[model samples]
Target: MKRLCTLVAAVLVSTSLTLRAQAEETINYITAGGIYLENIQKAYLDPVGKQLGIKWSVETNDVDTPVRVQVQSGAVTTDLVEFGASTCALGGAEGLYEKLDYSVIDNSELAPGTFSDYYVGSTIYSMVIAWNPKKVPNPPQNWADFWNVEKFPGTRSLYRNAFYVLEAALLADGVPKDKLYPLDLDRAFASLAKIKPHIKAWWASGAESQQLVREGGIDMIGMFNARAQSVISDGGSLAYTFNEGLIDFGCWSIVKGTPKKDLVMKVLAEFVKKEHQADMTLLSNYGAANTKIEETGKIPADLAPLLPTSAENYPKQIVTSAEWWAKHGAEAKERFDQFLAE
Candidate 1:
């Protein structure tokens, strides 16, 4: 009987030690600060950590400089990171990220083409035309209407970033949507010149765009959907159109040499779960990359139109091609800067 008791005690000790080992495991995740991080923590990291008996150390940094530094130095601390589509493409090519294990990190819930071998889509944000309905009784319906200062006469705001600005300019100049790529710099610049004097502010951040509209600083602007939604929710008399919207997305990636690659992949799988994705939208106003979440009917009807990935909105907008931008962004940006100066 004593031998029996000792065997049982040993079994219990082994189980306890294994559980403790599991509980002590940790993964470092880096993402943009503010509501994006907050929502991820509440909807994913905290809950998933509890379920998996692991800990997640959260950090915030928008740029991929830290990840790049870690990769070059051969001492990687970050396990997972959030990157914009273009940055992910550049980093993936440089071998800065690990090829994702889709078997463990399911991509089935995400929109088609949102997941690649090295990255998985995290959120969908878009550049939409936002206007104060009171200021412009007839809001600009499309990019062309935005450029027509004579018809919708008012102060305007645009992103300081050159990529979307050039795209918008080309579209406003009557370039067919199907032929937007291989952007015509000369024509885009010519189109921009017509609206240059009317642009009251060149916004560099989402907050700046939101402030301009909320305070009535700009009558119409090309702004982020998340920012515009904030303004609208604050009782600001603003309306945004998804027509001719420029779709942009950010993705999640794992550091190439992280020791916890398998565990990190499991965490990523949780990030794209329908429930977590839907909850993220409630907190950040950014669209869920998981298309399945739309069918869940958790997102409010009024808020659906604002999501860049919504069935109705997604079809009407142009998905920004990260590949094309990677190839020609520098030259386009240089020309755009020169146009701004002149």
Candidate 2:
């Protein structure tokens, strides 16, 4: 009787492993969503799925709300998500993601701070000043210039979030980039007060940022580099500058409690390849997370200077401090909400 029971338990364990492996065959990816989805599909998802012999689908969704809902409800439908770097810290803290398996996913290709225990950076993107040149020939060269309405003189837009807004405020107020964090919210909000009246719209999405640029609702706007580049490529009257651009990455994190981690890790491996990363850069103008993208000889010489990680422009911007934000994001958001209301 004891031997029969032990054999039955062994069979049950074997059947569970087999079922999980079968479940890993189809992978689902969640993205922050917008113009990025098309390219991400073309450059990374479609190709990787083919190469790995796995079926794949993607959802265009808000990374934070839906992910939190899915994780907390224990109905995790997606295998992986493209998270803002700071969101990775928040999600990990909330136990929303699996700790990454480094043995399967290589980190050597990633830049410093882009790799974390639960996630790995997939693309390096920038938030910059995108403008209609007809509206303002003399561009805001830096954050200080952006705050100077009397000199540049244009309606503006900024993201609705406090992350970049606070940093820009501090930089415009003459704080050096190197000294940016443990951010002085008191001073940053004071700087924001000066330009708040000039801001035409506090955009909530990437698509809105691009629309603001293309429709000429605002003369110059704080925008994402890739969104600006997408407009520029489409012959929209848009141009962008790199100075004071906030450099951050979108990283891949497996949803906690997913049954497909093994295959999800395989997808990440393919996503970060120099070739696939280069493919994305060509499509979106986001610099590849794989640093060796330069050495891949895939990017055109003319385009090299525009990448956020490019040698010529990287020095002009500030790298956001995820560690600092991870600790203070909630407090800052609370104050920013009150400030905006007041």
Candidate 3:
């Protein structure tokens, strides 16, 4: 009876080993919803997985709601997630994300201005002045200039998102970059109200804003540069100005309570390597989060100007405060909705 029991225990242990090996064969990553993940998977995840002796399977979806459900129910499918800064903040507050292992990941490899402990910003994107050059001979260069419809004179569109428009309003009201935080809510709202009558449409999506400018629904817009670049590249008569833009961040994080925690950390450590980071940035047309890529002559000139790494432009930009936004996002949204309704 003892001999028979020992043999059965050995078989059970062998079976467990086989299952563990199978599970480690592939790592899963969750990405932001869109074609963006295809490039990220091909450029970053797949190759890194191979280097780390794992296969990668990535899915794209909006963060927060799906992630919240998964964690609360003890059904965490996502191993890694790429989401907006605001989403990362919200997820952290809910205790849904794992604090990253900075020792293995090496924060020094990332571009100087983009690193953090809980999450690493994946890209720097901005809301800028997009104009149809043919329609307007002189494009707006600064906020004061942009707000001068009497001179630039045309129908304009801006983001429907509260965070962006509020910053733009402050800029238009001559608030310097250094003093933007602790934003004068009452004054900012009032400033936005002044431009309310001039807005042709408040764009609600990247696609919507792109189409709005391309189709001439509005001659000028406070636009997300990535979509604007897409429209312009596709032969649309649109051009963008980066001056006084609202620079925002998107980040990647590991979800807490995942069964595949070790695998996820390995994948992240590989994901931020210089070569993979450069490849992802080139395909995405966003700033590569890696500093070494910028230093080693890897970045292309045409792409360089658009990226946040170039020496000239990096200093001009303002880093959005994710922690502050995360804390106040719901309250800001509530107040913003009320302001819009009125």
In terms of lDDT, model 2 sits at 0.86
Deviation from native of the Cα of residue 119 in model 1, angstroms? 0.6
TM-score of each: 0.89, 0.90, 0.89
Over 4 Å off, model 2: 1-24
Candidate 2's TM-score reads 0.90
Cα lDDT tens digits, model 1, 1-342, are 999999999999999999878767988888887666777788788888888877878788877899989999999999999978877877887899999888888787788767788889988889999898888998899999999988888889999878789899999989999899888888988899888999998997777788788774789999988888888787888998899999888899999999999888888888888888888887778887888786667788887767888778888998888777767777888887888789
lDDT of 3 at 336: 84
lDDT of 2 by residue, 1-342 (tens): 999999999999999999978854877878866668888988987888778878777787665788888888889888889878888878887788998888888888878788888888888989998888988999888888989999999889999989898999999999998999889999999999999998888898888888887784688888888888878888999888998899888888899999888778878877878899999898888987788887778899999877998889888888898777778999999988898898
lDDT of each: 0.86, 0.86, 0.77
Stretches of model 1 off by over 4 angstroms after superposition: 1-23
Specify the highest-TM-score model's number: 2
Model 3 earns a TM-score of 0.89
Backbone clashes in model 2, listed as residue pairs: none
lDDT of 3 by residue, 218-277 (tens): 888888777787787788888886777677777888888887777777777777778777
RMSD of each: 4.8, 5.3, 3.6
Question: Which of the two candidates, 1 or 3, achieves a greater lDDT against the reference?
Answer: 1
